[model samples]
Target: MSRFTRTQKILMCLIGFFLALGLLFQGMRQASIGDIGYSVLSYLKYGLIDYPLTSIKNFASDFSNLWKVQEENDYLKEQLSMTENYQALYENAQREKRELQELLNMNESLSDFNIISATVIGRDVSYWNDQITLNVGSNDGIQEDMIVVNSQGVVGKVHKVQDSTCIVKLLTCEDKSNKVAVRINFQNEDTGEDAQSEETDSASRAESVEGILESYDADEGAYVVSLLDEQEVEEGMRVVTSGKGGVYPSGLFVGTVKKVESLENQLGQVIYVEPLSNFQYFDYVSVIEVN
Candidate 1:
């Protein structure tokens, strides 16, 4: 309408009027006038009324389905999130129960001592393997040099204490200053003595060797136990605290010999001991003392 001139628009209207007249006359000649009128009415009913109504109905149905689908999706997502949370909680509870069982066994083995159980609450990032912090502190009868142990063996002594927390110095500390008096319980028994042995432990009849666990090889994950003098330290020998120097108690498990080598200038034998304690993963420990 905008592009057409006023005269062109008038001409188009006239031509449409003539074409309608011709069609009307032709229909009137071929069919009854009433039938022609009825056909036009039928076209108007379908095109103007039924088509629009059906389209609106279909659109409403599709929109309702889309809304229901969105709601179901949201509901499923929420359920999945809740399930994940429950699964995590269940796993944590199982782990706690297992740790408690281990601690119970440890307590039975150390029934002679007054033991205070504590959770490992923190670790120094710079000295992760060397030290761990416990939830127990001086307020809970804790003090410096208190012996800390897990189900496996000696963890470390309490290095520092506060009102609510204490730091433990592990045997994996960088320096050799924290040496333990240890004895190697080896299977060097004579064949005749072994046949006569009644003890379940193979080292029961074997001769033992005393040494100092003064050095640690971090890369090898073993302790360098330097004997007083050159002696044949055999592999697979178990080491335990010797209870000398009034430091560690007798028979507390230390580690086993991974290998044995000679010291500098062959002055003594260097026994590499792999500890029983899993240094990477300990959650609970006990601070022990003589009753």
Candidate 2:
């Protein structure tokens, strides 16, 4: 045989090299496929060619899932917070509604009176007396000396008024003075020159028949009824507004009498009064607005 040419020899060597590499790669692929692996070995064979691309793809998918989960969590948390806030607001509104309804019921019970419901805005008992402030003012048609009443009884008169606030004097306050009539029904002793006990019924009747004089002194009685001279009031009787001055309306309930003093020249009487307004525990009140 003639000596092989240089080009031919080069071609032959290249073909042999390719043949060996093909066999080696095929054998390796068969061995990898035979091994038991879920996705690792298969990815290594196919994914190694563009390793960075495959890795980026996997990283992106994982990042997307994590982002979706975070967004869902944030939304759920926001919803829970809003739910709590709405529940609290609802409860507060219900409480306010109940209070308003009760106040309205009190307004309907008054006889012969026009009611103007107002809220208590400010209160100070410092200077004049136990005086409170109301939200009604001149613009709301509130005037001076208007009678204010609560569920229990009377509050006081309007002392001062601004555009949106008014000062109300309390009944038992130091500065405020009220005059009322009262009555007391108590059992004590009878006044007497002619007073007869139950035991001396027949004797007393026989004496009276003889004209021995049955003179009973009103002053000698243990309990007596008299006018409250200082307060211009009477004991053991209903104390109402005599309507002496134009200040208060007539027949408004002022208070009830507790006691009276007996005196000679004047109607001797002292009165213990229970104010109609329970100021100690009053929350709502009404002002009479006569049109």
C-alpha lDDT score of every prediction, in listed order:
0.84, 0.59
* lDDT per residue (tens digit) for residues 1-291 in model 1: 389999999999999999999999998777887788899999999999999999999999999999999999999999999999999999988877887788789888888888999999998788987899999998999988888888678877999999999999998886778989989876744567665574455434446878899877899899988886445778888888888847677788888899877757646676899987566677888998754
- In candidate 1 the C-alpha lDDT for residue 48 amounts to 96
Give stretches of model 2 more than 4 Å off: 1-106, 109-112, 125-129, 176-238, 263-267
- In candidate 2, how many clashes are counted? 13
Best by TM-score: 1
Candidate 1: global Cα-lDDT?
Answer: 0.84
- Highest lDDT, which number? 1
